[model samples]
Target chain A: MFELQAPLIARREVASGMWVLSFSAPEVAATARAGQFVNLLLRPGPLLRRPFSVYRATSGVVEVLLKPVGAGTAGLAALALGESVSLLGPLGSGFQLDQAAGSVALVSGGLGVAPMPLAARAAAALGLQVHWVHGARTAAELCSEWEGRRVHWATDDGSIGYHGSVLAAIPEGIGQVVACGPNRMLAALAARFPRAQVAIETYMGCGTGVCLGCAVPRTSGVYDRACKEGPVYQANDIRWDVLPQHLHYGLGA
Target chain B: MSGLRVGGVELRSPVLAASGTFGYGTEVPLCDRPRLGGMVSKGIFLQPRPGTPPPRIVETPSGMLNAIGLQGPGVEALIRDYCPLWAEWDFPVLVNINGESVDEYAELAARLDGVPGVSGLEINISCPNVREGGMFFGKDPAQAAAVTAAVRRSTRLPVWVKLTPAVSDLAEVARACESAGADALCAINTLVGMSFDLGTGRPRLAFGTGGLSGPAIRPIAVHLAHQAAQSVAIPVIGIGGIGGAEDALEFLYAGCQAVQIGTATFIDPNAIGKTMEALEALDWRRLVEGTRAAISSG
Candidate 1:
């Protein structure tokens, strides 16, 4: 992992309060992969670095999607253009795209969509059919700008796309499924598709293995560091029932 | 340019990574190992520990609270898996030994005593998050000295006792450790703290309370380190919320021979090296004399 000061090369308000920030971190962007994350150091209070999934990376520029949920994130949203921030990343294990046989399904719920665009691109590069499935509470909350080949949308309020929770809308018979969402959503998805790869969420400090803060218990009763052993792990390997079912990201599950 | 010796162990610089912040010294790459005096490994016990549950850390104002419960792979794993790597590093690596009893502390020191990579021992008598042993041995002068003396008798390596700020009399404990054969003292571990999640009506950390460290605790650390230094002749190594050169200078000015970077490493992995780069330009003799004058005048 590399740590460097990257300027705010680009920023956009994607949805109501959600934003997409792009930084000029060549070394970090050069090695970033799907499901991997970057820890951005914030200004002023809340001394710890905030961890965000690598949303996209192109031409020495890396992007991260975030909603101002806490002090650290809100500080990030107030930064001016060209302002530099410390970035440590391309950290943790990424999604296993090569493990797929033929087709790959990228499933995301709400802010869980943060890592799917990159996962979709990585799967496409490997010559696998990429099927993107996204869900949100309503049409206004949906991120429809995914540049994937085929996209499916699910909304709880039925304002657009498939009705009901995203879990009910997922189709069976997909070869390999990679998912990121609230722990409650991922827990249910894990039960349905026991073979799916999931990104678990927990409060983190250091964003490296040393702190041992973002630990998630495994089925074997051993706790694994989410920032090191994985932000991505095989679904069935996680002891989902034991995880506290709370929305870590601001967005709903 | 500025190098010093702490408790007889010669160091290349005065900036060391605090225990629990830098792991077994294996995870940090060579490129990040900038001009560091040394690094203290994470606290280890007699057996492997599972640590606390999830949500173990939470960000407060200018600091963070953590209750990691001293999760580690035990003393044997340290000698087998980590020591070989430490022996090859450019800087000295002190093992931060933790124990539930004085005998346990002595056994840990004995096990690491002549190990190739192990340069010294930093007895962790002050850990607030654990259920037993930890801060218990640190809060009382007799207990703290007892642990220090036990470890001192078991090994030939330099022994540095880490003090907890939770104690009512920080100087009493400092002098007791020095009298008990401690070569040096690391003053001011994290202050005990707690924060609640209003949404869930529950404590943010799974362990209810955790040790608070970061910029918020820097001033307290400086005061405590200064007080400890005044009470004893052994070199004082200051720690608590040290993030930059300014923070390290405060410790140095308060009579600390060296300072350890803790939570700051989480923000920038190169914090230790960066602080060292700034410290390289200082006149060490003047700094120490200035500390003596300031302390005497106060």
Candidate 2:
């Protein structure tokens, strides 16, 4: 892990309220894995650092996809080109692929798609056939697409491929699954696919396992910090029933 | 730039990472550990605590509110799991011990007294004295003194009593701890405060209220440190909203021998290291002389 000031290289509004921000952070980009994240400082106010999953990492740059839901994220979205942001990463546990599985399904919902593209690329590099299942509230919110792949889509309204949810769009014969989305959606995926490794999100303090603020209760009765023990965990390891119900996603309604 | 002598222990730097914020001092691999003077581990209780529920933290205008409820793996687990690693570090590792009663406090101190990895103990008297009906020990001078005395008797290690700003007369509490045998004093734990979420028609944090820390509380902390330093002879280690060398300088000018970087670690995990670097670049003799000159002129 490294803490460095990353200069903004590019920014793109991928969806209605979502943005894909690229930064020049060679050290972080060099060490970051598929599911690891970076914690960015929101300055001038709100002393707490906000955590963003690595959307993509290339030669000497890292990208983070975020939706401006609160003041911290809004500050990030408002950053101009060439501006610098303090980044602490590549942090937390990333996705662990099963080498034995010939194929895998990558699932995401809303801004959860932040980590999917990289995960897909990583899984594809391992010679595993990758299937993408992504969903959002609407088409405008769909946010991303992978070129030259068998991609599936779901939306709350009938304007998308699947009329209901992404959970229903998971095709059969996939030996492994990796998902990131709302707690409810992740829980449903866990219930349907016991082998799913789902990325969990929670409010964090230190993001280094010190504060114990972002603890997610596990099936064995021990609390695991999403920032430390995992931002990713196997389906059976989590106790979804006890997980907090309401989360402030920060996307303005 | 130079080390500080706090009671029997000698810290390599004057900037110690405050408890709760620094974790066990081993979690952040990215941080440069040797740059820190020392680090106080998270609060350790007699029994394990699950801490508060989700939304345990909320951002304020210039700081943040957090009611982590002292979540920890209990003293036994800490000693068993982390002591060996701490023992190997170049810097000191002070355990911040918390309890509900004086006896419990003494027991924890006694247990850590001769432990190889442990350097000292910071008695967290800000916790409620449950036997006395939820009154914070730090809020009552008499109770604070009694707890300090008991812990002092139980351990040979240097004891630093952590004070809370919620009390009316912080000087009296500092004096009480000193008289009862505290080696040093940590002025100002997080000030008890709360924030409301107007949109949800409810409190922002799940625990309703939390300890407020960061730049917003710096002035208040400085005032309290000044008062506590004036009222006691023991070394005062200042804490609360200390983000950089400038902030640490305020406490030092107020008579604090050392300062702990707390909330700033949330903003920059390498805050303590950076503050130490900043302090190294400063002319301390001039800063101190200037402050003294201003005081004398006034």
Candidate 3:
């Protein structure tokens, strides 16, 4: 819960709108849990604090995957290496990892794969054989790279490893599924297994629970906040059906 | 004597971070705020409300409007989860409790009673409720008094009424809260504002109308703060367009004992701590004397 102004160590353009930002936070990197996010305050105007899930964390470096959709991320991507940005986080409740599970598979889409790279490493730490299954529009979008962990790639264009959605190739022995992506992908995965923990993204006013801008409906006929109760939730717990049917992410019951 | 004795509690610093702007105590990221002041967390309602749809905020000229709709996990969640975290910190994390019904507000206030981390309550009366609740309690003097009286009786914690500038008679409402035994007053919540989306011909924000904040509302906020301070003997905490110590000084000069930092924190979460330091560094007594002499000579 401590706030420290961390020095930006490295910033690289991963893709057109995608960026890889690394900060020096040994305490946060060493102990930051999966699915927890850090709120990045972008200076100037129009944009304020933006919350991005922790992508991957090294000994003293915490990397976040960001898509520059607005002024905040765009400004963040433009920061110099030695520049310091006000970051208050390693916040919000992260993914719920079940250690006793035998076979584990990770499903992700677009920049939604932000938390999975670290989750895979954590799974390896738990001695679980993990399979990283990632889905993107094409080969260019699959920016996730795992060194020793197994990764299975899928793209919509038939341009990558698997020529279909990652949902289509859920391993037969998968005892547990962890996902972060469009709501549609999560719901589809949920419908397939009716079991999986998913990280939901909501454009929040305050990435912390106080604002309550980021809330999703739960099966109990109530809404659960993304910042507090979960950035992650079990498939059956979220009320996907109650969501407006317009967004591409939450489609499919 | 420096500690502000507002009703039942004494705030070490009169200044506080406005609600809905600062997250929980931990969300602000300062190692500690034993120096600056206190933090007012986002609004908490009786039940969990999904709130308004997406595109919740829109930037206007020198301001930003937000119709966040009091999205929250209910007041119980705040007590159960957020309070424990606040207890770990040294500063008082005041909870801003809101609700559609007086009973709901009372229930929330009752729930917060005896909570370890809760220092006080700031009642936000500007929440544009879509449910059974007609409008904000602050808009109507009678209702504001009733709500304030109810929450005041429900908890022993000091109660502060956060007034919205949208009301017709701001003095009437501020006076009502004072009569109802409010400890302090935070005048001028965000003003109602809107923006257009030429691309889709729809409103820029998913919610049609949003609360306007930032420099655009500063004058109006200061005006209300001055008026409210004059109307009641209780201390008034000015809010709006307070991006720095200079802005805060304006509010203090206008008669508010303290001021809050809102929209500015979005750009720099550390704006509060930095501004606090900058203000403390100034020879305020000498500056005040200089300004007094100038005003007298002029």
| Error at A140, model 2, angstroms | 1.2
Q: What is the Cα-based lDDT of residue B196 in candidate 1?
A: 81
Worst 10 residues of 3 chain B by lDDT: B1-10
TM-score list, all predictions: 0.96, 0.95, 0.81
Ranking of predictions according to DockQ = 1, 2, 3
lDDT by residue (tens digit), candidate 1, B47-90: 99989887788888778889999999999988999999889988
Comparing 2 and 3 on DockQ, the stronger one: 2
C-alpha lDDT of candidate 3 relative to the true structure: 0.75
Badly placed stretches (over 4 Å) of model 3 are A13-17, A147-149, A243-253, B1-3, B6-9, B20-33, B36-123, B130-137, B140-160, B168-184, B194-208, B214-216, B230-234, B262-273, B283-298
lDDT of 2 by residue, B1-298 (tens): 4446885678988889999888898776656676788888988888897776667877776777787778789988998999999888888899998888899999999999999889999988774312321237888999999999999999999899899988989989999999999999998888777777666868777778888888889999999999999999889999989989999999999998889998788667788888888877896547867888899899
Instruction: Give the DockQ-based CAPRI class for model 3.
Output: incorrect
Kindly report the interface RMSD of candidate 2, rounded to 1 decimal. Answer: 3.7
TM-score winner: 1
Any residue pairs clashing in model 3, and if so which? Answer: A3-B29, A183-A249, A184-A249
- Candidate 2 lDDT for residue A47: 68
lDDT of 1 by residue, A1-253 (tens): 8888889988998766889999999998889999999999866546778899999988999999988887778878888889988888988999997644678888888889999889988888898888888889998988856856678889999998899788776667778999999898999998899989999888888887888888888998888899999999999999887666763433210
lDDT, candidate 3, B1-298, per-residue tens: 1455543555555556888778676555642275547778888888876677655655566676787777777887878888988778656777888877898888888989889988899887776534445256777899999999999899998788888887888899999999998999988788877767655666666678778888888999999999998899998889998988888888877877777888777656567877777777885445655776777799
